[model samples]
Target: MIPLIEARGLVRIYEIRKGPFSRPQPVRAVDDLSLSVMPGETVGIVGESGSGKSTLGRMLLGIDRAQAGEVIFDGRQMPPLHSQQWRALRAKMQLVYQDPLAALDRRLTISAQIGEPLDIHGIGSKEERKERVRELMGAVGLRPDQAGRYPHELSGGQRQRAVIARALAARPSLLICDEPVSALDVSIQAQVVNMLRDLQEQNGIAMVFISHDLKVVRNIADRVAVMYLGKIVEEGSSDTIFQFPRHPYTKALVSSVPVPGKRLQGRVILQGEPPNPAARPSGCAFHPRCPLATDICRTRTPELRRIETGRTAACHLLANDLAVAA
Candidate 1:
């Protein structure tokens, strides 16, 4: 089957002005990257902070404009912002942010927040909207009476549910979840994650799940994409990527996951931090910190290539030999 969402050579750059008179410097939050999600599949994007996961997620949802490349949804290229087609396309794509409380209006009641989309699109009458809002609340596992309560009146989990309910109100075919449960308590996080999974199963909604927690990703994602320095370094089936990571960065990330009663061997933490986008390192962006870095890796960037069936990694060491230094 064709993919529900496809991002090709996606690039998103932000301009930072050092001074009022200084020239604006471009920060490549998301570099030339591409990925896709089949219908009803969950693709997890995992990375460290500042790895551009969130930016990529935002660009995928049409919340942030890409500087270049294409974002195709259901086989149609999303038009540029301010265009009628763009508005229409966004109606089928929605986003669930990290902080539910912050995303919601403090003063607006839960009913008002979830029903806002129905009102915007004129989906139904006042009576119908109210009924839909109640259903939405129940869908997210909240009581119908909670509708009249303000955001502050609800617990953290309830607030997150409200946000999810709002997103579902659009009946979107694709959902971008940007650390949707990171802010909640552990027990609450499980509840939210299970709820999201159940909803996806029932609605057949394709999702791009972005988070720093690999453990969480393992629980929900069918496939996984590991990103570094604004680019996807490795991607494959979640089971393969988690069990037999080929990329050095992927191995290091996997090593960092704590196992019960057993101490993990030396970690692959690179020496220096990620380079600033304005001055990205020459050749492979990860070469500087890669323990397996060779002369070729220093000056030549490796294109993403399939190492095994359904698994791809961008690494010089993996090209000529299967033995990757990690």
Candidate 2:
């Protein structure tokens, strides 16, 4: 089956301006990354801060253009930003931001914000759009009375629901949710996550869930991608990744998640901070933090290759067609 959205070898760089009279430093926010999401599939992208997860999300939606490579949505190349074609395409792909208050207009009521997308896409008549807005508010579990309330008047969870309601207002084919529930409480996070999952399954919407929370990703994703320093270190089925991580970075990330009622015995605690993008490491970016780094890991970059069916990882220690770790 053809993917709903595909990013091929995307590269995005930002030039950071330093002190007075200092030259700008180049930071490759996303480097040579590629991904695709099939209809009704959820691909979770998990990584540390500055790993380019958010950058890749914007690039996939064409909000951030790549210096190299292309993005194809529904078999058509993404158009230039703000173009007519891009505007029309926006109705099919939507983004759910991490912060709800920031995403919503303070002056407008929740119902107005939810109904705005229908107006933008010209989806229906005035009465039909109003009905659709009411249905969406109900779908996201928002109360009828809360419709007229401003963003600041609602709780964090309620505000997030409003944001989600607005995103769904467009009936997008693909939803890119970037840390959508990170700001909410644990219980609220579960509610929102389950709501998103149910909504996706019911609508058959493809999703790209980007988060730093591994547990949440494990719950929502069919496939998982472990990224570090703008590169995908591991990609595979979510179960294989959580149970039998092969890459050292993937292992460390999975180990960081505390298992319920279990004491930490074989946890892989990594040392040192991730290298700055302006001055990335010589060979493998994770070598500075990898516990098993060797001469080869420090001298050459490992390509992300298949170690087995439905699994791929980049690590110098792993042999071809064989895993270094179970």
Candidate 3:
């Protein structure tokens, strides 16, 4: 079966503006990343702040144009912004941002905010639109009466719920969430995450969950992808990634997760911050911090290769000492 969403050789570069007479430097935000999402499956993408997870998320949802590469959904190429095909595809894909307040229009009422998409798509009559908004509110765990309130009137959790309601109002097939719960309090984060899981099960919608928190991703993702310096270094089932990480970067990231009274032997602590995107390192991007890096790693780039059942890693050490203990 074909994947619901497939990205091949995806690359997105942004040109930075310098002062007068200065040449613009192109920053490679996403460097030839490839990903596929099965129907009704949740794929988790985790990395540090500048790891390009959010940029990939935006490209997946058609919110950002790819400098090179293609994003195909259900066998159709996604069109660029404002094109005829893009207008039609927008109805099937939606994005939920990290800061709900930033996405929400503070001047508009909740009802209008939710109803606007339905209205733009010409989904239903005015009365039916109002009813649909009410149903959407209920779907995201908001009361029907809350539709009249402004965004400032609600708490952070409520604002996020409202944002989810608005995204669902479009009846999108794929939902790209970019750090959806990173801004909320610890207690409320669980509630939002659980709500998303419940919604996905009920709607059978495919999701691309992008976040920096591995713990949160572990609870919701069936498969997990680990990225570093704008490239996916490792990807596999969540259980395998958390329990038996093969890549040194994956091992170091998992070690950082707090586990009370449980100390892992030979835990690897990654050294130094990720290199600048403008001037990335010569060979393997993680070589600067990889304890297993060999001389070849510093001079040659490692291609992503299949390492085990349903697991892939981009590392030159995959031939010998890369085996993970069972």
Candidate 4:
């Protein structure tokens, strides 16, 4: 089956200048990364900050142009950014940001904000838009009377629900949610996550859910992709990746998740900060902190390859260890 969204060898770079007289240095925010999201499938992207998860999300939505590679949505290559074709295609793709308050217009009523997309996309008549907005409010668990409330009138969770309602107004086939529930309280986070799962199942929306929270990802994602230094170090079924991670970076990340009633023992605590993207390490970016790093890991970059059925990892040591085990 053709993927609803496909990203191939996507690369994004930024030039940072140290000083007025210094030449700008190019930083690869997103390295050559490829991923596919099937219809109604939720793919979780988890990593530490600056791992390019947000950048990857933007690239997938065609909001950020890649320095290299192409994104194909629903089998056709994505149109040029901000072009007429792209604008038309935007209705089928939407983004839910971390800060709902920031995403929403402070001056506009929740109803108006949710209906804005319908108006912008020319989806329905004015009366039809109003009715749709009403339905949306109800769908997201907002009361009819709350429609007139401004962003500040609502609580954090309500604000996020309003944002989700707006994103879904156009019925997007693919949704890229970057840290969607990160700002909410634990109880509210569970509510929003459950709502998202329900919405995906009901609308059959394929989602690229990016977050640093492994527990949440494990709860909502069909598959999980672990990224390190702008590259996907490991990817597999959510259960498989969480239960038996193949890559060292993935192991460290999974181990860091605190389990209830279980004391932290043998947890892999990585040393040192992530290397500067502008001056990435020679070979494996994680080698400097990896306990299993060998001379090969220090000298040659390992390619992401199949480590087992339905699982892949980019680590030389893992491949060698798996081979020896076999």
Candidate 5:
């Protein structure tokens, strides 16, 4: 089956201006990345902050145009940003912002905000839009009476639910959720994550769930992609990748996820500072911090290579077993 969305060789670069005498430095937020999401599939992208996960999400949605490569949606190339074609096509996809308070308009009631998508997409009449808004509120676990309240009137979880209800207003087939539950309390995070999973199952919507939390991603994603320094170091079925992470970066990230009722042992502690986009290291971008870094890792960029059926990783030491590396 054709993918609901496909991004090939996506590259997004930004310039950092320092001073009048200094030349601006170019930074690649997303570099040579490719990903695809099948219909009704949930793909989780996990990485620490500044790994370009957010940039990739914006590129996928055409909110931030890639400097190189292309994004195809439903067998068609993504139209130019803000074009009439893009505007109309947008009804099929939606974004769940990380901060619900910022995402929602304080001036508008929840009912109006949730129903705005329908109005923009011209999906239904006024009465029908109102009915759909109520339906979505219920679906996302928001009360009908709460629809008339402003964003600040609700708690963090309630605000997030309102955002989800708004995103579902047009019945989108694809949802690009960038750090959807990162800002919520731990308990609220579980509720939102489970709610998102249930919503996807019910509506058959494909989702690219981006977050830094591996435990949360593991619970919600069917497949997982681990990103580091603007590239996917490893990707596979969530069970396989999380249980047996291949790349050093992936291993470090997975080890950091806490397991309840047990003291963690042999956790891969990361070294050095977080990756600097403005001054990206040469060769393997992860070598500076990877414990398994050898001479080859410092000199050559490893291509993402297939390890087994439906699994791939970019690492110089893939031939050796992970135990040996440790």
Candidate 6:
């Protein structure tokens, strides 16, 4: 079956200048990243800050232009940003931001914000839109009485639910949730996560969930993609990647997640900080901090290759494992 969304060879760059005399250096925020999400499937992208996870999400949605690569929704290439075709396509894709207050309008009431998409797309009549807003409120676990309140009037969790309701008002096929639950309290985060799962199961919505929380991703994602310096270093089923990570970077990340009843005695703690994107290392971007790095890893870039039936990793050491397994 064709993927609901596919990103191919995506590259996003940003230019930054430190001083008046210095030249603007180009930083590759996303580099040659490829990923896909099937209908009703959740693909979790996990990485530290500045790893380009959020940039990749924006590029996937066409909110940010890529210097190279294409995003295909369903089967066709995505339309150019802000084009008439793209405007029409927007109705089928939505973004849920990390901060609900920032995403919601301070002046608009919750009901108005929830029904705004319908008004913009001209989806239903006034009465129908009003009823739909109420239904959406209930779907996201919001009370109908809170509909008339402004964003400031609602709690953080309630505001987030309002934002989600608005995103779903148009019935989007794809939802890119960037740190959707990171800002909420732990208890609220679980509620929202469960709600997201329920919504996806009911509507068969495809999702790209980007977060730094490995445990959260492991809970909600069918597949997990571990990113480093804008490239996907490892990709596989959540269970495989989390339980038996092949890449050193992935292993380090998984080891960091605290396991109950287990001590942190032999965790694979990485040594150095992530290299600056503006000046990435020559071969494997992760070699500088990887404990298993060899001379070959310092001189040659490893392509992402299948290591198991449904798992892939971009590491020189994994190549030997593949040969042994073969």
Residues 1-326 of candidate 6 have per-residue lDDT tens digits of 99999999999999999999999999999999899899889999999888999999899889999899899998999999999989888889999999999999999999999999999889989999999999999999998889889999999999989999999999999999999999999899999999999998899999999999998999999999999999999999997788888788888888878889988788767778766898889889998897778898899988998888889989888887633121
* TM-scores vs. true structure, each candidate: 0.94, 0.97, 0.95, 0.97, 0.97, 0.96
What is candidate 2's lDDT per residue for 34-124, written digit by digit as tens? 8889989999999999999999999999999999999999999999999999999999999999999999999999999999999998999
Looking at model 6, residue 32 earns an lDDT score of: 91
Clashes of each: 0, 0, 0, 0, 0, 0
With candidate 3 superimposed using the best TM-score fit, by how many Å does residue 18's alpha carbon deviate from the native? 5.4
Order of all candidates by lDDT, from best down to worst?
4, 2, 6, 5, 3, 1
Model 5 bad stretches (over 4 Å)? 319-326
Q: Estimate the overall C-alpha local distance difference test score of candidate 4.
A: 0.91
**Candidate 1: minimum summed lDDT over ten consecutive residues — where?**
262-271
How many backbone clashes can be found in candidate 3?
0
* Prediction 6 TM-score vs. true: 0.96
Candidate 3 lands at a TM-score of 0.95
Minimum summed lDDT over a 10-residue window in model 5 is located at 317-326
For candidate 1, give the lDDT.
0.88
Candidate 6: list runs displaced more than 4 Å.
260-262, 322-326
Off by over 4 Å in 3: 17-21, 260-267, 320-326
> What would the per-residue lDDT of candidate 3 be over residues 1-326, giving only the tens digit for each residue?
89999999999998886777789988888999999999889999999877889999988877889988999999988878888888888878888999999999999998899888898899989899988998889888888888899999999999999998888888888889999999999899999999999999999899999998999999999999999878999999997788888888888898888677867656566788866777778789888887777799899988998888899999888845556442
